[model samples]
Each structure stands twice: as C-alpha cells, then as structure tokens.
Target: MVAVRLSADSNGVLETPRDGDRMSAISRRALLTTTAGAAAGLAVAGCGAAGGGKQGAPRAQRTGEHSGASGARAPAKTVRLIGDGSTADTGPQPNQPVVDRLEPGQTPPQFVVFSWDGAGEVGNGLFPRFRKLADDHGATMTFNLSGLYLLPEDKKLMYAPPNGPLGASDIGYLSDEHIRMTLDNLRQAWTAGHEIATHFNGHFCAGSGSVSRWTPADWKSEIDQAVAFVTQWKTNTGWYDEEPLPFDYAKNLIGSRTPCLLGQDNLLPTAAAIGWRYDTSNPGGDQIWPSKRMGVWDYPLQLIPFPGHSFEVLSMDYNMLANQSHAATSSDPRNYPGWRSQATASYIAGFQRAYETNRAPFFIGNHFEEWNGGIYMDAVEETLKHIAAQGYKDVRMVSFQQLTDWLDAQDPALLDKLRTLEVGEQPPGGWKEFLGQVPASTATGGAGEGAAPAVTATT
Candidate 1:
C-alpha cells in the first residue's frame, strides 16, 4: 500500500509519500480525489481536474495512509502534481475540437527522412551527399538534429548528454571546429530549404513505461531548452551579414523524432503546450493525424525487416556506419563497390515502394557516420538518382517545420478531419511501418517489467 500527498507550490504540482504508501506521478492536469473504503480493503484515488486555471483555495490538505491487518504499513511511493486544488474522482476531459468536419479524399501523405542518435562525424560526412541527392531528386528533407549536436563542447551531447538524465555511453568525437563546420553545413541546408528540427535535447524516451518517469516540468524544460538553442543559432546566423534573417519561417522550424523511435503517446499535452505540430519519431502507416491528440500529425517511415532478422536494418546500418570502425572499412575504395551497391539497392527498393503507392512523403533515415566511406557516399548518390527516376510530379522535398506550417494554415475543419482519420493499428502500408519500430529501453534497462522501452541497441 502507498500513501500519496498532492500539493501545488507556485512552481507546479508536487507529490510526496506519507508514512507507508506508494504512488506515481501523472503528466496531465487533474485534481486527485481519494475514495477510501474500509470494507472492501481498497482505496481508489480518482483525479478530477478541468483545463488549466486557478481554483478556490483548499480548505484543508488531505492525507491518507494504509496498513495491513496486523498494523504493519508498507513502504510508500511518492508522486507529485504541479497545481493547486483538491483531489477529485474525475479525469480531465479531452480537448474539444474547434472544427469537426470531414473532407472526401485523404490528403496525399508526404515522405520525410528522419535520422536518430546523433553522430556529428556522420552528419558532417553525409550532409553533402544527402544534399546532392535531394537536389538531384528536386526534393527537400528534414533531419531531426539530435540535441547531442548542441552540447556546449562535444557534438554527441546533442543526442544524449554526458552527465544528465539521458546520458549513457558517450561517443562524441566532434570538436568545436568540427561542430562549427557541421553548423555551417546545417546553415547551408537551411538556406537550400531543408528542415532542421529537434530530436529531444536529451533523447528522452517517450513510450508508455519510460514516459511516466518524466514530470511535466521536466518535459517543459527539455523542450524549452531545445527550442531556445535552435532559435538562438538561427538568430545569430541571421545577423551574420549585418542583416536580419527573415523570421517568416521561424515558427515552422518545429519537428522532432524521439530517440530510439519511441512513440510520443504520453508527451502529447506537453508537445501541444509547446506548439509542435508533427513528430516523426514513430513509424507505422500512411501519414495520420491522431484523434486523441489534436493538431499533431504522425508520419511514419516504411521498410521491411531484413532477411533472418527480428528488427529492421536502417537504424542498425545507421549505427554501424556511424561507428568509426565502419569508416575504416570504407578507406579501401575497392570494398566500397559492393557495400555501395547493396545500400543503394536497399534504399531504392524502399523509396520505390512508397512512391509507386503515391505516398509522396517517404522518410529515409540514416546517421551521419553512414556516409563516411566514399562507397557509402556513392550509394547515397545512386539512391537519389533512383528516386529521381520515379518521376514524382511535384516532388516538393520539405522539412518537418514546413509540413507543420502547411498543416497549421489549413481550415480548422480540415485539420480536425485529418486528426480524426484513423490509420488503424499501424501506420499506412509502406516504409513508414518498416521504420517505425526502432527499439528503446528504460533507464534501468530491464529494471521494471511494465516500464517503457528504454534506450537500447535494437539492431
């Protein structure tokens, strides 16, 4: 048994355990109402809170404790909420949609390429090739830049920090000079109309089990810092030539791919509060705007699991390619031929599957290190040529931010319809489904059985 206490300081909701009890903190805003029943030997706590706002002051703070028949109390788990109010039995009502109308045909879904787990070397190595490929195909792409790249020192810090909440084994090799070069490359991409967006400053896991560990405040801080950092960079660069860069596209500069492809089901409210419209973290089907979370659309990548494999190969190839050892393999130009041909073949098959089906948006993700070898670069170039050969009518390659802006500007009714269109259990048929299931582990790895998938080596 657990005793839970709820209190709201000016900062937010805080929860602490009483004598002998256990509790868990929830992310939504709702007043927790405790219903105690002695006869049933059960105490059900209900949370009833309305939308965010100040309520009447509490008459008295309520506290409860539970013990066994022998009068022996169990250890308690502490949970907290950040608001002022009494605990209630009701949960929060879903946000009402402003427009609830439907259109006839589904909007043609867009293909977006997303990479995960930052590797500055990989980013630096691959961007040129990727840029050329995009140019050849006349398509734009979105790179969910890992927060690891933004670390004050090492570039890998952009993916997961060295000592913070999400850090594990740090493998950053990019120095300040390298980072500046990488940033310059990003600026070039931005100038060329590519999308640069956040992949979580700390690569925070977003699935159900792991997500419960994040407090609302924690979410706010992580996202806020990421947005602030990117905004600051753009602002600084805009003034580089003694002229203000146009701010017309600043707001559209929002897109994210959670580390390890963990879904953001639990972080919707926090994301909404921060004004993000699309997250490419999870892959499943054709593009979908989920009904439960308003305004956000999910575009999943599609690919099939490689032969004799439990998982797909894209992320694995990404990780392997990013590791320096793989770069050494590419030093020999002769060996590049086979690997390049294989990689290009794989990517072409994936892209063609999506394109032939009219899924205009296809996310082809890879880590920066994947392009270290000249062979890998050649493969990437070949893949681009293959995509171009498909003859996409208006292959408007776009960044995640651009997609969000377009969605935001649509009629509210259209937006609602997009959100309500269910893609069934998984994302639409294509590479989106193939790429959506990247593995993520919990903090303790396997510490908690019901816990969400934490960071782990999936491939």
Candidate 2:
C-alpha cells in the first residue's frame, strides 16, 4: 500500500500534468521535509549517494561449478559459512558476468539495469519466468526484495516497522507458502548472479505514515528490520529442511529502492552509515553518468523518451501505465495491443536515446505484477530481446551491483566526459579520437574502441 503517488494512469505510473512538463512528480521541498507522508528526492527511484564513503564492492572469489573455454569442468568451490550458518560464501559469484573498467579510449557499453520492486516469486510465475528470460539472454538483474515477502503472515509481529504500530504495514505479509517460494527464488537468483537489493519493509506511503516522514534514525530501524528478515529467514521460518540463501545478506546487500521513491534525503545517510554502496530512490534524472551522493552511488530512475510525448517519463512501468490508462491497473481489453506497443516503444526509444548519445547506464524499474493485461511484461521481454539483438555489441542487461562494479573501476575524468553528451548526440570526431585509445583486434570498426574485455577482481 505504498502510496502509488499521483494515481498512475495504467497502474503505477503517476498522473503527470496534462501539459506534459517533466520533473514535477517529486519536489525539492518535499525531500527536505521531515514530514511524514510527502514525496522527496527526484532521480526517480534507482536502484545512490555522495562522498567517498568507505563502502567498496566485495572482492570476487570462485564459486559453484564452472567450465573452462577448453570445455574442461573446473572443480567446485567449497561453501564457507559466514554467520549463524544462515548464508554461505561458495565463491566468485556463479554466472556473474565479467565486469571491468573502461580503457582510455573505450566507449561505455550500453548498460541497461532491469530491476524489480517487491521482488517475490508467487503463484503468478512472473518471477521464475523472467529468471529464465535472463538466463536465456545471458543477462543479469536486481531483485528489490520486499522483506516481508520472506515473512509469513503468522510472523507479522516480527517485523515491527519504523514509526508504525507493531506489525503494521501498508502491504501485509505474504502466505507461508509464498514465503517459501520467495525463499526458493531468492536463493536461485543469487546462485545465478542476480543481485538481491531492498524495497524496505512495511512499504509506508502518505496517509499511512509513509517513510517520507521518517528521519535517519527511523530509516535505520527500517533497514535493520529488512536486514533481520533476510539474514534470519531460517530462524524466522524454522524451515530446517530448506537450505539457506547462498550469500551473506550483510555483505551482499548494498543498494535499495525506497517505497514510492520517497524519503531518500534521510535514506541516503542511513545507507552510508551502514556502508551501503547505493540508493535508487530519486524520482527523475536525465540520461547521464551516475555520481556519488551521500558517498555512495545514486542510481536513480532516469527520465527517458516516452515515444509520442514531449516530456519523457521515468523508465518505470507505473509511469507508463499512468500515461496510458490513468492509474487503471486493468485496462479495457481493446487497449492491450496499443498499450503493449506503446510500452515497448518507450523502452526501446529510451534505450536508443542513451545508446546513441551519452551511454549513460539505463535504470529500468518494474514490479512483479500482472497489470494492464500483462502488457508491461511483454514489453520488457521484447525490449530486452531488441537490446541483445545482433549488431548491438557491448550491451548488457546488468544488475545494479554489476553496473556499480564496472563504474567504480573507470576513471573519473572519462565519466565526466561522458556526462557532456546530450540526448542522441554522438561523440565528436568518433570514438578512437574522442577517447584517445586503439580498438581491440577482435572488435571491428569504431565500436571496438570502447568495448573493453571483462576483468575479475579478487580480494
């Protein structure tokens, strides 16, 4: 029940002013407010903050089974438990794509981050379905797990969210069966190299004492609750038969998407204090290289081409839904085809805008929902296929964590240069001259210059 702020048109997309002016969804004043249910922070939700805070990406270690290019199977890594035997370090993240720094003359790859809010595997099957989709495409994504999704309704009292009464949540706990399903999916996701991030617990929005009202102390409470739920799932669920998650939540969790994209001003500090690496709660930002806010990466939702509209919408399904159907989660049957097309086109246009111009990492957000006849889901799958299509070299469907690793490895000056390009603007004098480096032998033409090979960094 996070306030679907601005009552979206199709489902979760906010109803923007008819004039189509962008950037009005969230206000600066709202973010500065210590008030309880208003909106704040406008990069559009990420998946962020400033300063060179102490957080760094965990060093890579070998994990699971792997095969050499020569086709010989590598020995499996031993699983080492971290804490309470709830999570284990099996080694380099299995199936995690190689992430390396961009060379002096390399053009940044078109990194598209496909992330979800309240990620859970339920009867809908969308979770497993997309997991297969990612594997099919050799892509990775971030799953913003809503903590309560791992908590059964019977264990609701265990949550105790910030500011609200005990066990109080706008969106209540899931069924025990669903919780187990969520657990299964979460474990599989990590093993497959997908990132597990947060959407916090209790999902407060305006009128329900939304998180927007909470202070850093309030946010810490929320963060602690979220962490406890993931790390203590075995203890909470008491499902001894089930194996624990494959990674340490305390070590693994580094990013989040605040509910409704609210309360980031406070959330950033809380994130930094806990050594988190990023926050994705900004409401609206352009296609540009991300920088640190509050000392961590602020990977906010971007404002991208909205196809027919003059104002670009946040790259999120809810915004698309609002623009098409005015907050109607279920639309007229007749509108399905057009809505799907519009949604698909928006995603492609947004991707192309960055692909052609700035090469800023695209942060696309979605929920595991069956809204608007499931048109958004169809649109995302189609868009991903298009991104991975032939001739699209250097394109990756990455998780926010993977994207951050790659970004952190780059030179600050090079990223600053990237931020100079406008929408659809190509580099002047081409890639080699612009970046002052030579292309690899395997890479053909100008595109090869920025396509650096992947690297592994071990602690």
Candidate 3:
C-alpha cells in the first residue's frame, strides 16, 4: 500500500485530518453519505493527488517493441516528429483489439473499461503497477491524464484557467522529476495500446471559479490549453533530452472525464463541436446501456450493487471509500479486511449482473491514490483478475476509445435493442431468439436492399 500526499485546495488551504490528507481539496458535495437502507446518497468521485516521486530514469526513446491494437507488433518504421518534437506520428496504436460488427444472433462481447484519473506517477509506483497488471492479463485500459501534471509548477502562470486568475490551480503541480516520470509513463502507455485521454486542468470544483459554472466557451478554452500543454511541452519546458510522446495528442484525444464529474452539461457541446467521440463525466447513472448526448457517446459512472447494503454505489474507488468510512482516506485498522472484501465484491457483482444479463459495458474509474490503506487499489486489482479469468474470447478488457470504435461499427438497431434490456434483466427469450429478428442489412458490414426493421421489443 502506498501513501499519497494531499494537495492544497484552490484557496491554498491544507486540511490534513488523516495520515494522507485524502480529501484535502474535495468539495462539500463530494462528502457523500450512504445509509443502511436503500436510500444511499450519491457522492461525486473526487480526483486524487498529483504527487510525484523518484521512479528511476525514464527511457530516452521509444523502442516500438509493444504490439499493435490487434495484439500484433507493427512493422519496424521510423518515427516522424511533430511540432518541437514533443510528440510524434507512430503509425497505428499497438495492443488495440480489431473492432468487428457482431454477426446476427452473436453474443456481444462483455466490455470492461478500467480507467485511471490524474494519471500521474509520483514515485508511489501506482501508475506502473497497474500497467504491469494489464500486461500480465493482456488487457488494455484508459489513463485520463491531467494536463497540469505535465506543466512545471514554476511555470504555473502559463496556465490561465477560466473564471480564475493567472497561475491558479486546485490540484498541486508535480515536481520536475515527477513530470519526467509522467512523460515516461505516458509514452509507454500509448505504445502499449492504452489511451491517453484528458482529465482537463486546474480541477476547480468549488466556489465561483468552479468548473461546474463554466460555459461552453470556457470549456473550449480549457480544452485548448490542455492540448497545448501536451503537444508543446518541449517549447514550454525547453527540455530537449527526453523523447516525444508516441502519438499525436490533437488526433489521439477523442474523449474526456470532467473534473469532479461536474460541468458535463456545458462541456458536452464543446466536446461534440471539437469532434470528440465519447464523454464519461455524468454521475449517478443507472447500470443501463449508454446513450448519446450532443451526438457523442455518454458513458457515465454507473450505480452498481454495494455489497451488504440496500442501495448501490457509483462504480468508482472514491465512492466506495465514501460509503465505507465516510470519505476518510485512512480509517480504523480493524475495518480494512471487511472493507476490502466488500469493495471487491461490489465490482464483481456489478460486472456479473451486466455480463450475464444486459451485456452493457462496465466503466470503473479510479485515481492513483493509496486511500484507505490502498484497499481500493487491491480491490480493483482483484476485480480485474476476476474478470480476466472469464477468458479473453468473450470478456474483453478495453479502453474507452477502443470501445467507442466497436460501438460506432455496430448496427444501430442492434444497439437500440440491447439498450431495451434494463439492469439485471436478460434478453427476452434468449440471445439466439432476441437478436435473430434483426435484419441482415442492418447488421454491421451488411449492405442489402431490405429496409431496416423497426424496434418491436419493449422499451
């Protein structure tokens, strides 16, 4: 178990109530309270520390040794640098699953997305720990990188957050050493087939300067800055020794998860206008099939069954901690054993319900935190292994970008039919009969003369 340093709030207040100061910057609403009955209150999953520590010297260049998106190594090719050589064009991404349209009556693959927030590596080893885990299981996940993590704290004024003064930030900036480590992890993550999406910057979640109040124009500004920090790190930092990132950020970033799960209502328009493919910022969503908002796929944090409780909890590590110990990052030692088991069970139960019934994709969000003695991290590791044991043929662990590719390639009618199945509700009759009625022309890659059939299933 690792311990993370708590970042000061936007106002520079450091409230250290526990060993790690877990919620030092968490908003009031983020202090979620769940009860014993079926009336548990929903709380937002707050972002964790952006702390960094010594992790070893980062590799100076990309070897391109990792396999491609389809699990096959791409042919050796020269890398063409972009901009000031902060990033490069590395052909197709590696470790990506080949997206194919599901044949009629075929069982849809159970998709599980394990995503990380504030994807910073602060010497705690959480970042590389999970990357190794994914490698062991042949799984790929998304790392929602915060742009501020790359910007040196000394260059804080470079960022002009909307509704706030110059150099203002809620989450602390990583040290130069940590920043180098972050760059290294990002480079390796991309080449290993994991997505490097945005988690925005500043992490402002409270007061007038909070992201929740930001307008679409404000969101556009924030997104632009986030991209700049990533694509032009060389120009900003003046560091020429390190290698550029493997992929082009401008084209690679197709999705994001807003800070504190706030401002999505306004962020959606800017996301769609910018041609983003998906958004996972919505809160307290049911365990049902996802729909689109502003023409972009909406993959929200779902309400999964909370073990030993009447109500459910959000499919996130922070939410589990909130319910278990009232948001305390460190709690009574006696409760650790039971809490770990409960958290593990919660994730597994959620996955089983969807995999056995509706086949809805499972989205789990976490931070590189050691909250509650790092039990949440342990639970997440266990959950990943549990699902991986189900065999890769049917249970495919993927990134949000990979999942979106599959979704876009599918038959819309078939997807609509799948959406009809509610949480824990199986397909009417069976898989063979329920999907057998979909017309062939509407099937993926099918181009026939027959018209697509209307939805006859109960909504």
Candidate 4:
C-alpha cells in the first residue's frame, strides 16, 4: 500500500498531516481528512493497489502499440466491418506511439495528455487545424466526440436524453453539413492515430435530469444512444457517398469524458461493465500519477497554479475562461492580449508543476470553439509548440489509452513508491539509491521513467 505524504488546500498550502507516502494538491472537495482516510476515500475499489473492476466484466483490451518517440502505428492489412458497415478496420494507425515500459534507472516521461471536448469539425476549421498541430508535435490526443454530431439537425427528435424532453440538449444537434464535416475530421483523425472517445449524447450539464444527477443506468442509456448514433449515422443521415469511419467505434472506444466533467461516480460502473480502460471525467485532481477508480484509470483535469490568483484552477479552457471572463464573452478586446498570455502561461505552469516535481502525467482539456477571439486556442497552440519542441524532446504527448497501457504494465507497488514523491520533490536519495532494487517481472517491468527540459513556471 502507498503511504500518505501531504495534503494541501486549493492554494497549494499543505494542511493535512503526512506519513510521508502520497501527497495531493487537490481541491477541498477531493482533499482527505487524514492519511489512511485519504487513501480509503480515494480508493473506492476492493482490489488493493491494483484496484478492482466490475463484477464478471472483462478488462479493457489494449489495441495499439506504444510506438515510442516516433509515434508510428501498425498498418492495417485489410479493411473490414464488424456489424453494419459504419466503421472499418483500416490497416495500421498512422501516428500512434507504441506504449512501452520504462527502463531501469530511467526517470519517468513527463507525459502530457491533450484532449478535446465535443470533438467535432465545425465550419471554423478548428478540427483540422488542431489535428495538424498535434501531428506536428508527435502528440496523439483524445477526442471526446459528441454523438449528435453524427445525427443531422433534422433528426434531433431521435435523441432521448434522460429526464429531458425527447430530442433535447444543452448543446444542440449538428446540421447535416456540419455532421458531414465532423465525420470527415473523425475519419482523418483516426487515420492519423488519435483516439476517438465519447462526450455522450445531448450534453445536459445542469438543470433537472442533467449529468450531475445521472445514475449508472441513466448513463448506460446515454452511452447506448451515443454509440447507436455513431454506428448508425448512415441510417440517421442517409449519406452513403462518404467512406465509413475506419474503426469499429465500440471496439475503438475505451474511454470518455462526461459533459462538463460531472457525474463520474455513476458513470464508472457503466464504463467498467462495457470494458472501458479509463475515464477523464474527474472534476478536480492534481498533477500526480493517477490511480484507478473502480478498476478503471481515472485521468482527471488537474488543478494548476493560476497566476495572480489565491486558488488554483482546473487545467481546462472552460474553467480558465470562467475565471478570466465571467460571462465567457470577449466584447472588450483590450484584455485579449493579457488574457491570452495568462491562459498560455497557465498551461505551461501546469506542465512545469508536474514536470519539475512528481512527473505526474499532465492532462489539459480543451474545446474547438475560439473563445475570447480565439485567444484560448492560440494559448494552447503556443503551449503545445513549446512543450513538444526539440528542447523538451522527453515530453510525450500521448492519448489516455496509450498512457493507461503504460500504467497498467507497471508494477503497482512501484507506482505507489513514485506516489511517495511529493509534488516537485525529487527522489529522496537520487535515482540510483531510490530505485536500487528492481521488482520481479510483470509487463515489461522496468525501474524508471523519464522527464523533459524544465519550462519556466509562471505564478
């Protein structure tokens, strides 16, 4: 079992008593009462450190290889469909990095997972724009696709979101042309070796019957609808000229981020039963190595050092916009430059926070919208360019699935030992003495991970 180290409040102030094991810069809501209390509270499964999964449900399968620094995918020999020809098994994925085990005496890779919500191609061309950006940086991101993006606006009434009126959504249905564009981008993204995860159907973030109050059963229905919409988009939209998405979404899909990052407690059981490998729906987490929740990987948006703020903020564009511009508007162009700098710096700071310390995987969430005259988009792009640059070659910008594979292949106890390193605290006695004794063979059992060149952290 991993020992508990330190617990800090939102402002990075340590308040919880420490036994020198695991530490967290978690928000008040995710903070623990004590050492054991925190471990007990955080670990919801009964499977000890390895964590547990659903009853009788099989574990999620690892499909892609960790292609190392090159991020190459195995070419598919032939294309074939599983059921209705909605998706095909196109040969090798073009840009995936094989998930490999860390070697002995190696420092952990400073992993940064860049993901998008409602990952669809709009008329603004952000989808293709970012896809190229990711490819250029050797980054493979998780695209949490909206189900209704495949269903045309004319077919809006087909959706049945829980508790809401039939065919309703906080984020409305997509137009037929937009759906086609979304499909085009999705196909291209899959070919480029990025992950296509779900964002659920009919994103009802709040009000009665929203995700905040959804149950396991409710989530199942939503998930089913989301899948059905994608696999049956041909029937839904009657567009036969386009080539089908080049992967069985049911098999390809192994994880998701919920609408607004709410209702994860109820979502996990459903996800586990369906053999999903991980969930990025967590609302508040730190830049520490992630632990499994309900036997599935819990990769959450971390709370990072927000410059000029008393408390840290979620490492997501939405939260940053909420803090910088309360109404999510950009009417005053005067604040654009400063706001852009702050947003960009926030992401860089979040990466540095983990990179310099625990080397926990940094997860940055974004959207396709050009919020604040697209300053947030610019901010994220700038951060990506720097982090994936030659100077920071050790930074591995991977998808959640690639990361989970690496994590699962690891010896759990070793992960617990890594957990003992507090945020920004190096190995107690350096790498040699700290990881002196290697454990028995597991999946590619190795002694260490790696890190990148340090980026300046802005407050």
Candidate 4 global TM-score? 0.79
lDDT of 3: 0.72
Q: 1-459 in candidate 4: lDDT tens per residue?
A: 111113545454222122232322211111100112232112110000000011121111111111121112334256676456677766555555555555455677888888877776556667777777776656778788888778877888898899888888656655666676677677666766678889887665435765768899999999999999989888777765456777889777889888656678999999888888789877667677787777777887777877776667667765566566642334488899998898888899888878877788998887766656888789889998878664776688888866776776666556766777765677766766665554644433222332111222211
Q: Which ten residues in a row have the lowest lDDT in candidate 1?
A: 48-57
Please tell me which model should have the higher TM-score, number 2 or number 4: 2
TM-score of candidate 1 against the unseen true structure: 0.52
- List the candidates ranked by lDDT, beginning with the highest: 3, 2, 4, 1
TM-scores of all candidate predictions against the true structure? 0.52, 0.80, 0.84, 0.79
Cα deviation of 44, candidate 2, in Å? 9.3
- What lDDT score goes with residue 213 in model 3? 83
Pairs of residues clashing in candidate 3: 52-122, 53-122, 53-123, 68-94, 68-95, 69-94, 69-95, 69-96
lDDT by candidate, in order shown: 0.38, 0.66, 0.72, 0.65
Q: Across residues 1-459, which tens digit of lDDT does each residue of candidate 1 receive?
A: 111123423212123223223323221111111111111111111111000000121111111111110011212322221111111111111111121111234334444443322423222335555654565455555665544343444323333332254433222223444444445445344444555666555432222223235555555666765555444542322323221112222354455655434435655556666666666654233323422244455655443222222333332233223221222323455655555655566566555554444443455554443233545446555666665575665343455544444444333443342343332222244334433332332132111222122222110
Q: Pick the candidate with the highest TM-score.
A: 3
lDDT, candidate 3, at 171: 72
Model 1 stretches astray by more than 4 angstroms? 1-125, 154-174, 204-213, 231-250, 283-294, 305-339, 358-360, 371-378, 405-459
Error of 4 at 367 (Å): 0.8
